[model samples]
Target: MTLRLLPLLMLAAATSPADAVPADDAPQPAFFEALRAADLRLATIAYRLTTANAALCDQLQPQIGMPIHALTQYAPAARKAAATTFRFGATIGVEAVVAGAPADRAGVRANDSIVEIDGKAQPALPGTDAPENAGARDAAEAAIANAPVAQPLRMTLLRDGQRVPVAIKPVAGCRSRFEILLGSGLDASADGSVVQIGEKFFEGYSDAEIAVIVSHELSHNILRHRARLDAVKINRGMLAEFGRNGRLIRETEDQADLLGIYLLANAGYDPMSAPKFWREKGGDIDGGLFRSRTHGSSKARAEALVAAARDIAATPTRPIIPAVLATRNVPLR
Candidate 1:
C-alpha cells in the first residue's frame, strides 16, 4: 500500500469492550473464537517485543513492522467447487503468518492456498516444529529478525484454477504493526499511526472487516487530522481551548471516517463493509460501549459513513496534475 503523507498527533483515549457482536442470524465460526484468543496473546508478545527491541525499534524509527496474523477461509479442494459455490472448512481459525509483513506490499488475496515456502512443502515440516503451528508465537518474529533485509523470498500459491509462483521483498520504514486486543471497543490516534480493536470485534469480523479498521485509521493520518486539530487549537486561542477541543475532535473524527471510506475503496477493499460491520455489531448505541469510547456512537458512525460513501460513489474523479515540461533555452514565441 502507498503511504499517505500526513503529520502526526498525540491523541489519547481509553478503551473497553462493549458493542462487538455478530448478527444473531449469521452462523458463528468456531475458528474465529480461537483466532481472537490468539490475537490477544500476540498483542502481549508485541508489547514485549517493543520493549525488548527498543533499540532496534528506534533504529527502525518511523517504520512499524508487525506479524501478519494468519486467517483461514474455506476454498474448494477441487476445481469444480472453485466455479460457483464454497463452504467453510472444519476447524477454521487463524495463526500468525510467521514472517509475513504487510509493509512488504505483497498482496495476499483472501482464500489463496499456501502450498510451499522456501521450496519445502508445508505438510513436510514436523507437526510441532512448523512456524505456523509452533507453540511459541515469536517463532515467526525470530525468523524475520534474523533474515537479511530486502532479500527475495518465494511463495507458491494456488489462485483460481492455476498454480502460481511469486517473489516478495520486504521494504524498510513502514510503521504501524497491529494486533487485535480482547474486549469490544474502537480506538484510533491522530496520526493514523495505530489502531486497537477489541477481541470480541476481531472474532466477529472477517479479514476484510479488519482491513476496514486499518484503512480508516490510515485515513486519519492521510487527512492530517492531528495537524488540523493543532491549527484549530491555535485559532481558538488559549481561553477557548478546552471548550472548543471536544467539538474539534468530533469533527475531525467524522472527517477521518469520510476519508477512510475513500481510502479503503481505492485500495480495493469493500467500501460498504465498514457500515455493515458496525450495523451488525450494534450501531453506535451509548457511544458504542460494547465497542470503544473513542469511536462515535454506533448508529451515528454507521449512518454517517454510509452517507459519506454514497457521496464518494457519486463524485467524479479529479484529473491528475502533471509535472512541468522541460524547455529549450533559446526559443521565444
Candidate 2:
C-alpha cells in the first residue's frame, strides 16, 4: 500500500493508448514520440512524490499534476504535430491529463484548453517570434501553476468545441514543477521552483529508477539547498566541486541522498531502490552531481544509501521524514 501501486501503474501504462488515440493527420517530426513520452514519465513520477509527501514540504502548490505547453515552443516542423496531438493552441493548453492525477480524476483529458481557473481568464502567450520558444513554455507553466491551493478550483475546459466546467478539489502538494529537457545527456538539476532531467533519463530507466533520481532532485528544493548554498557563497564553476569549495557542495549532495530515499519511500517506492539506481547508473553519468570530486564515489554513495534505507526499513513505523530537514535553513558549514 505504501508504494501507491495504482498511480504507479497508471504511469506504467505509459504514453497514450494505441487504440484510443488517432494517428497524426500531418506527419509528425521524428522526435515527437520520444519527447512526449519522456515528459509524461517525468511529470508522473514528480506528481506522485509531490502529492504523497505534501505534509513534509514547506511550500505548497495546488495538486493539478498535468503539464501544459504552448504551440510556440515547438520547432516549425514539429509545431503542427504537437498541437494536433496534444491539443495546444496559440495560447497555453493541457499537453496531457496525466492519468491518475487530480485533473484526470476531474475528467480533464489530453488536448483540453484551460479557458479559465477560478473565473479568471488563463494566461496567454503574447507572441511566437521563435519557432522553438522554451521561454514560452516556462511562462505558460507559470500561468497555470499560479492556480491557488486554498480551495477547490472552478476550471473551465475547452473540449470538443464546448466549454465544459468542472470543480477540482485542490490537494496541497510540495510546490515544484517537474520538466524534461531535450537532450541525450545524463543531466539532472533543480532550481527552487523546478526540477529538470534530460530526456535520456526517462528513455533508459524504469519507473523505480526514475523515482530515485527525481526524489533526489526534489530533495534539493525541499531542503532549500540552493538558497543555503548561495548564502555560503560556494563556487559553481567547472572545477568548483573540489577542495574547500566542494566540501559544502558535497555536504548538500549527501543531504540530498539521505533525504531523497525517504521521499522515495514516502511515495511508496521501495527505499532500497535508491541505492540500486545510483550504484548501477552513477558511473554511467558523465556530468552534474557525479562530476564533483568531493561527492562520494558511486560505490560509496550506494553503500551510504543502503545503510540509511535499511534503517528506515527496520523502523516499526515506515516513511518518517529525516530530522536533518529540520536544519534546512541553518547555514551550511
* Model 1: residues with Cα > 4 Å off, grouped in runs: 1-95, 98-168, 171-175, 183-192, 226-242, 282-297, 311-333
Once fitted onto the true fold, the runs of candidate 2 whose alpha carbons sit more than 4 angstroms away are: 1-30, 123-140, 286-289
For candidate 2, the TM-score is 0.85
Worst ten-residue run, lDDT, model 2?
A: 1-10
- After superposition on all CA atoms, what RMSD does each candidate show versus the true structure? 15.0, 6.8
lDDT for predicted candidate 1 compared with the true structure: 0.40
TM-score of each: 0.43, 0.85
> Model 1 residue 49 lDDT?
30
* lDDT, candidates in the order shown: 0.40, 0.70
For residues 1-333, write the lDDT of model 1, one tens digit per residue: 111100001001112223222322222233333443445343333332332223222223222123322211111121122112212111111122323344234654433444544454432212222222222223333333434445755556555645567565644332334544333344333344444554444444566666555555554554455555565453333342244555555555665566556655544455687787667754433344332333477677889879766765675552111110011111211
Question: Per-residue CA lDDT of candidate 2, range 253-329, in tens?
Answer: 88988999989888889899988987788887735547747477788889999998888888755448778689788
